[model samples]
Target chain A: MLDYSALRTVAAVIQTGSFEKAAGLLNVTPSAVSQRVKLIEERLGIVLIVRGSPCTATETGEWLCRHLENVGMLEEELLKQLPTLAAPDEARQRVTLHIATNADSLATWFLTAVANFTKQSHHLVNVAIDDEDHTAEWLQRGRVLAAVTSLEKPIQGCRHLSLGALRYRATASPDFMARHFPDGVTADALVSAPSLLFNQKDRLQARWIRQIIGRELAGPVHWLPSTQSFVDASLAGMGWGMNPELLVGEHLKAGRLVELRTQTPLDIPLYWQMNRLAADRLADLTREVVQTARLLLRHEGR
Target chain B: MLDYSALRTVAAVIQTGSFEKAAGLLNVTPSAVSQRVKLIEERLGIVLIVRGSPCTATETGEWLCRHLENVGMLEEELLKQLPTLAAPDEARQRVTLHIATNADSLATWFLTAVANFTKQSHHLVNVAIDDEDHTAEWLQRGRVLAAVTSLEKPIQGCRHLSLGALRYRATASPDFMARHFPDGVTADALVSAPSLLFNQKDRLQARWIRQIIGRELAGPVHWLPSTQSFVDASLAGMGWGMNPELLVGEHLKAGRLVELRTQTPLDIPLYWQMNRLAADRLADLTREVVQTARLLLRHEGR
Candidate 1:
């Protein structure tokens, strides 16, 4: 069996981002924290935490953190079954579940799912946002127990469930379309029109552009990273972007924004991936994600 | 003179994240793009692009990007004065200016400032998010040309303008107040109540708690990263948090939310810091940010 106390020390160091802070939290000396870290590294024969001002866990350390997460789940279940075991100061028993998700989903329907779960459960959460295509990497690295991802196939030692596709409409304010596509959205016109890109990782615009225009063009772009601000920028005639239908449905109906193309929407299929060990234990979260996504995301690929 | 062709090549690689994509954008062969990158790195004797599937810039590379930004500003100025010099396909000439700001500022009043700026200016922006106390580091590292920071002192070689304090109220939903602080808030009651945190970098709750009750206690925390979600979680009775006054004013007025303590609020002073070279050229942005922040943020640090 692993030393649970030392493992928690490792978790504390990563959480607080320093040996001194971790030691303070654990009510131990900094040297004691360092000694435990060094001993664990020797036992595992791998460096766990990278020594820095704000310390970070290495891949091996992340695996250990995942182990502790599983242990936390077991403890939570055990205490549920035997109420007498819980300390009177049981508020401290609440363990934070780290989950990864894309920003667009968070803005649209993801929070509703989690909010309902947190309402009933003793669980709290740490939500880390990355691009849809990349959230799986967070799960693979053991940085997060589960993720909303683009990968339909489960990563090794993980369970996969389809969460349906998030549909996007290539939209712009009417003024912008009239000014830039007066002669229609031809390849030449697209080459000169401005686009709104979320970041380098965001490829919804690039994918939609290729799907519509059938080729790649280096268009000028405004990189605005917020989902709400992305819609706001498009509405303000800054650039054209692939706005999630949920975010712009009202604007589109009111004719404040117009789609670049009629009857063609990009559907990005999403999946929920979770560590196999934690799947049954975190069943509530999985259910909330799947049920919410089913109700909200586009089920038909078209 | 510095090799601008090589510099643009560097920018393309970082923006596109690979040599092949950079080559495609520049209408050059992959080998030619590679050659230009190598020549520039050798001439400067520093690694500009960190070779990866998605190439990233080193600190030195960021400084070079900042240089390119200044040049783009100058060229934009020149083209405006001499309209005939601008090519018909000048949409490609739109340059992305990078700025860093705190999440609260973005959610509250910063976007309004930039929104108005974009309505008139030809410039597009890439906004980076960080904790207010840490945003100045983005300017210091040359990753961003300007930032909304909590630092009253300007970073070296940058202009600083005070942009007032953002006031925060320590608040909870009526349900939460009734459940957790039925007998009125005290240190003992707070020790058992769950609290919402923006992230580890967010110290507002901890600071507020220290001020109100006058001691530190290890309370359970829910780490919700979104500015909007933070307020939503509070409304849902998930936990108490220090929410910005701008975001919670309506809730307070409607009595949906109540302060954890009345009459005491934490005020975070903000400032705008920009690269000296870009300061004069990007005057409109500085003006918009300062003006908007002045109108929105709390003038007196109460």
Candidate 2:
């Protein structure tokens, strides 16, 4: 029901933050970009974008953008299947897919999936990083066509695939453990010792503390938001916090970091959520992600 | 006068996103935390925080938090100057300072300044990274006590000190240059070539294209948001992009990357802006940052 070209123009405007800039990127005149947006709004009979210094999409516009992205993926798949119907120049234009994920996943096995997908498909990726618990919000707001999230439920109109569990261990540097917990991890020592947190929204440390000590942890906290930096901070004896088993495996093996020896490691099950559009490219990407995740990540039940 | 302890409690609730969590951090009862927040709201006659799954500060509450942080810094400075009047327990608590900066700065010379300052002062830092142009908004919103920003003018109540300019050179990996621009960087080659960008908000590549070809660029762009990842992508022959001279100097020297040899490298002037509070700690921090910047960054007119 919507003009795919016009929708593409709308997305370009929001992404580039100006009609003029979008025109430059789209290789069209500024007036042409403006007219396309106007045409879409007229056809839809709703305000799509609030024109400003930096354009922002209205709620309806965001949904349209997401739809356009999915449609683009479907078109790519169609052209691949039926080369006779494709334009001669169609192969030159690679589809750009926007995905939302957490920093840890991106720094770990997720990129392996992305690299594998891009090798076989003519698609470029734009990744938006947020907390695992919050990545679904980006998908709901239509900022991303797909998301890697911890939520078990799928967003409306989206299909969910379980990627498997990312196990995490509470770890600290060897020197830090000896210095801070010489007498073992008592409540009194934990109350005075320093701890590292990924962010205020991160509840891994709190959950781990409640599990280990059966009480809340009131400690000096250092918030490092970057995944690599969080690992570095922990390795440099700044504090101890949960690190993904995949990331800390080398350090643990090298004897640089020591596990706190809890009863069980924390396992956060990740799900791949995508719009339920019949797109071969999306399906291919989903298959690659699932296959790669299963190979690298821990199985949910096992 | 407002009770600084109550003000701190209010900040913790907003930061940790729950009164119960803030109580645990403060080593107090949840009811006591609620009472303190209520007392402050009544005294200020303004709604400070919105109760929600994750709490957020109202506009007025943000200002109060900033004020509380400044007061804490000033109190620490006062105790340092007149140790005789200080409570014995005050020395044990390190004051935490929140600052806003750009990623390039953090990945380059800013850590040295932080390390030096931490060694000399009993202060821990929490840094929030935003674009250099937008860090002023964080300062204006009272989310940070200081910011490293590109704006020359100070926010209404902040002091601005010029920290010199960061020079950027457009560079590409040796192999990529040989493949894409074999005959040198012509406008035709640029039109069809893949390019790297930090994000959609980044205009460095477009600006460089306009400067060189006198027209806007219409090319394929890969948006890489992480500084280290951006550099790695460039190094891995993903595409050509502008890199900070400080960051890519070694690569340039080692012949891993080659500069495109533009007419002039882009030099973005950076300034340190802080609230105009008479705190010696703030003054000391400003001095160290400026000193480190002058040593590493290019001077204004040079």
Considering every candidate listed, which one attains the maximal DockQ? 1
Q: What TM-score does chain A reach in every model?
A: 0.86, 0.83
Model 1 regions more than 4 Å off: A1-3, A13-66, A78-92, B18-20, B29-55, B58-63, B74-92
- Whole-model Cα lDDT of every candidate shown, in order: 0.85, 0.79
lDDT value, candidate 2, whole model: 0.79
Error of 1 at A101 (Å): 0.3
Residue B78 in candidate 2, Cα distance off native in Å: 4.0
Query: How far is each candidate from the true structure, as Cα RMSD in Å?
Result: 3.6, 4.2
Q: How much is B122 displaced in model 1, in angstroms?
A: 2.4
Q: Interface root-mean-square deviation for each candidate?
A: 2.6, 2.9
lDDT tens digits, residue span B1-302, model 2? 78778888898898777899899878899999999999989988998988885787888877787787677777777887898995776566657788888878876777567646654655667778877888898888778888999989878998988999888888888888887898888887886666777775676677777777788766776666766666666776767888888888899889998887544588888999987763345877788899999999999566
What's model 1's lDDT at A19?
86
Provide the lowest-lDDT 10-residue window in model 1 chain B: B86-95
